[model samples]
Target: MSRAGSRDPALPARPRRTELALLLAALVLLALGFASAEGDIRGQLSGTVALYAGALAGAALALHTALRFLAPWADPLILPLATVLNGVGLCTIWGLHRVSDPRASEAADQLTWTLCGIALCGAALAVVPRPRMMQRYPYLTAAAGLVLLTLPMLPFVGIDAFGAQRWIGVAGFTVQPSEFAKILLVVFLAAYLSIKRDVLSLAARQLTIGSVKVFSQPRMRDLGPMTVAWGVAILLLVGTKDLGTSLLLFGVYLAMLYTATQRKSWVGIGVAMFAAGACVAWALFGHVQRRVTAWLTPFAPDTYEAEGGSFQLVQGLFALAEGGLTGTGFGQGRAADIFASDSDLILVSIGEKLGFTGLAAVVVLLFLLTERGFRAALESREIFVKLATSGFAFLLAFQVFVVLGGVTRLIPLTGMTTPFLAAGGSSLVSSWIIVGLWLRISDAARRPEPAAEHGADAATEVLRLRSG
Candidate 1:
């Protein structure tokens, strides 16, 4: 019998057949949806259909080819899953165009954004060949993140729409700075936490509610980081009024800290701080108060009609109810009736059209994506990589929960977009960049160590010298 430590035969490199098949299936589904929605396969194919189909196919193939060569050991399902969801979203948006407004170019625009997102993903993979190198610039990333987060609050460039200053206008293009800022923020948190994990885990104080010892708090120095994070979150609330982005960034920070130290005390402290901050915002800001009130009493007539009230929330709930089982079948439901069906409420539109079954599939796909990220985190050799990958994974999971939970009336609406399904260039691009990071990290983590190669090369050199 072979010993456990003995080397086995080399495994063949994966050709990614599963990924290719899934990609083809996703493209087929997109074409089918377009054909069905238009009711004219021949004419649509001769014009607009060909353009989107070609673009998606080319983009998918380009990314796949890059992965095949650049990162063969990376998880295969992630890219294809994102592709399928994105394609379905494009189809759904295309269908909603007729119902919401004819001549709307949302689908075409989304396709262009999708292509741009893929291009960015490729660029990220090329630029950041190794995930470990990112750990060297924690301060730089943190400073850049702060700048990006603050950009949308500037008077000259910032645009206030829908009662929130969450966008900056640049050259006639509106960009959501918080979307990209979150990525930079996560990287900084990961790098910082990896270095301070030991110091943070050290208990500075023991607290007891009554007789039972509850939790141990970190030192004053350790507390400084959490304070800064909380202050930033509060600033975000006061400045941009974007509860979702603030909550997301702060939540990611807390999670990474806890993950680094395995300390429940940190989470408890974070939650308590969040609650306090939330109460203060509720007391100080009328809009924040209105949101809490609407969340608690959405069906109230006054609350439903009030500006920024539960009207959209009530409409979304009604739409979800209408889409009982298998959905109203694409393009059959009046999802367009709800405001912003293409962005914040895209999931509602999806629920109305495809029903619970389709929604379940989307949720499962998200879970799978998040699962892959966690797996990479677990397998990674470096502490920074582990923390960064896990933090990124949690960000995706929490954002989905926040968005879906908000629309379902399970929580207050926070005006966040569903990852790939939502129609926003900033969101789409950011999510794709996350995907690139995941793939790059996973490839590095899973690829066999080079010790064996070095050993083989040394033996070859020795043999050549002896023969000579």
Candidate 2:
């Protein structure tokens, strides 16, 4: 008979049934959404529906096949969840396109970018056979990230649009490098913290008022790196004039630091620093002041007519109000009336047409993705993988919060795009790449132990029992 506790070595058929099923479901849901928006709203069928569906299905299949063959043990939920979210975005954009500029083919462009992003994701998986290998180049990745963040400010190459110089133009194409910078910076922090975590956690001073200890604070010497990080964030704000990305980068750093050191005091310090910086920026920058004014009193005529007016913000709120409970139903809503409906105000558009029910579903999907990233981090064997995965998760969570909160007027409108659901090619591509990295890390964390190792342990146990 077979040896007791021995396992099959013939590569277990991880056929990924769950992924295939979910992909099919996502495709059907997308098709139904397109049909509803087209037939119910426009009262006719368009040729582009078939084209969009075919492109999405093909792109999803391509990525799915790659993961199955290359990273079979990868988290099955990430790709499928991304597919559903991307599909919803495509349908929504297509619906918006019908009203905004029917002839522009922006929906088709989004589909093309989605394919490119999937291809890039596949390349990432192929390039980094193991996620742990990335720990080797923390500083190099950090340097590259900084360079990318600074590129959009270059004299000739930089493109100024929507009051922020956050994109670089090359050969007629504009690219936002900040999206990719988030990933590289996360990598750097993960590697850096993996080495310094023990020291940072242990070398903290406890503070007390009289009898009760308030909190444990890091040493003044240890504060140098965080202070430097703060300066870099401020520089990013001043240089690019992009508050969303600057906030995102800094929020991610703070989260990673806390996760590494497990110090609640870091949270207090980071918040205080961010608040102080925001006050300074508000006082110094006209644009910052205008955004705050708009958020506070958007309906005021004076605020409404300014350069960066509250017109868009007020309109987005009206759109959401129009959505109400069940939404205006696909294409029936006036989401297109709002500026940048497919990007900065996408949540508003989604809220308007899909209503509270649909919007809630979307939010749940986002949180689910974040949860998977956190799960990967927890399961990871190496400290670097854990911190990196956690950072990526926090990045996604914080970004979604910023986008949704801004659109709802809970916070000043920051020019940030909703991931996967937004119109920007750079944002879409970078989101996919982050998902790819999460999958790689999850695969490494969850892969089955070698049969030899298992058998060896069983044999050792049996020998001990025999001796006893």
Candidate 3:
């Protein structure tokens, strides 16, 4: 008999069928959304709608099929959730393109990138069947991450756009290396911390005031990792002027550190260090000062009218206000009038067209996606898988917070793209790769234990011996 047939009847069945059902439902919804967007943009549905919908469905189904064979026990919700978000992005971008100049239309490009991303995601699953294999090359990944992080700073390659030096133009293509770098660094951190969690978790010194325990500190030697992370964050902030990435890199580091060590003091010290660095940057950098000024008084005529000031911020706020509770309905809104309506300020565009209710629904989906990552982390058996999965989850959560917080003025506007929803090939590709990693880790976590299978075989053999 097959091992699966001989196994205990009570063992949980794989949910691959459920995954297929959800994937189909998500694709159906996306098709409807694409049709609706096309109708609204052109005043009638075009045949191209069918073409786009078919392509999207085909890509999604391909990924679903890969998971069925490669990762049958993986979480079912992740692929569907990602599909919904990515489809929403495509529809939104298409709508914006129709209303804007035809010469600048990016809908085709976005679709192509989406397909490439999904293909890469499937390829990731095929290549890395085991997540633990990555743990062996922590230092190598770290070195590669540092190189990518600094690649955009090299002369003759780095290109500055929108007041930030964060992209490199090579062979007629501009790429943001930091997007890929973040994942590599996360792997490095997870691997490093998993091996050192015991040392980092144990308190080396206890601070006391009048016999009252105040705080516990990690060993001075243990501070090397934090110091390196802090210094890298500062360098990113200063060198690239990319506030969003710098904050995200350091934030994920702290999150993974705490996840591995469970040390609140480490978090406290990291935050304090970052705060000090931010203050110094504010004092020393003109761009930092300008951003702070814009955040503080966005509506002031002087700030609003100045170059690199709060014009985009105020415009995004107006778009959100116009959207109000029910939104302006897809292509009807003027969000496309604002700069970067498809990229950095996408959340505002979504809020303007989809309204607060639609925005809330999107946020809920994002939360569920992040929750699934955390769930995988909890279910995982290996420390490395847990930390790596949780780190990726934290990266997604914090990136959303930074983007939404900026658009809403809860924090200074940081030019960060919304994952899966923004029109960036680099971001989309990296996101799908992260999804593949999540699937791999979750499969390993939820797969039936080999030990149990062996025990079942032994029990069956003993019964045969007695009968004989």
TM-score of each: 0.91, 0.93, 0.93
Candidate 3, residues 1-468, lDDT tens digits: the string is 245536453333447778789889988988887777777677788777787788889999989888878988899899999989998888888778777864564888889889999999999899997888878888788878888888778899998887788899978778898899889988988888888889888855878999996778888787687457646744864688877898988899889888888778779988998899889889988988889999999999999999999999999999999998988876687798899899998888889888999889899999999999999999987888899999999999999999999999999988899999999888998999999999988887887554444678866764553232
Task: In angstroms, give how far residue 367 of model 1 lies from its true place.
Answer: 1.2
* Tens digit of per-residue lDDT, candidate 1, span 154-265: 8899999988998999887788988888888888888888878888887568789988969888887876774575467448646788888888777887888889988898
lDDT of 3 at 80: 91
User: Best candidate per TM-score, number?
Assistant: 3
Q: How many clashing residue pairs appear in each of the predictions shown? A: 0, 0, 0
Per-residue lDDT of 136 in model 2: 85
Clashes of 1: 0
By TM-score, how accurate is candidate 3? Answer: 0.93
Q: Flag regions of model 3 displaced more than 4 Å.
A: 1-14, 452-468
lDDT of candidate 2 over 25-141, digit per residue (tens): 888888888878888557898877888888888988888888877888788889988988988888888888887678877888898889998888888899988787888877788
Evaluated at residue 335, the lDDT of candidate 1 is 79
- Decoy 2 TM-score against native: 0.93
Q: Cα lDDT of all candidates, in order?
A: 0.82, 0.84, 0.85
Off by over 4 Å in 1: 1-12, 40-46, 208-213, 456-468
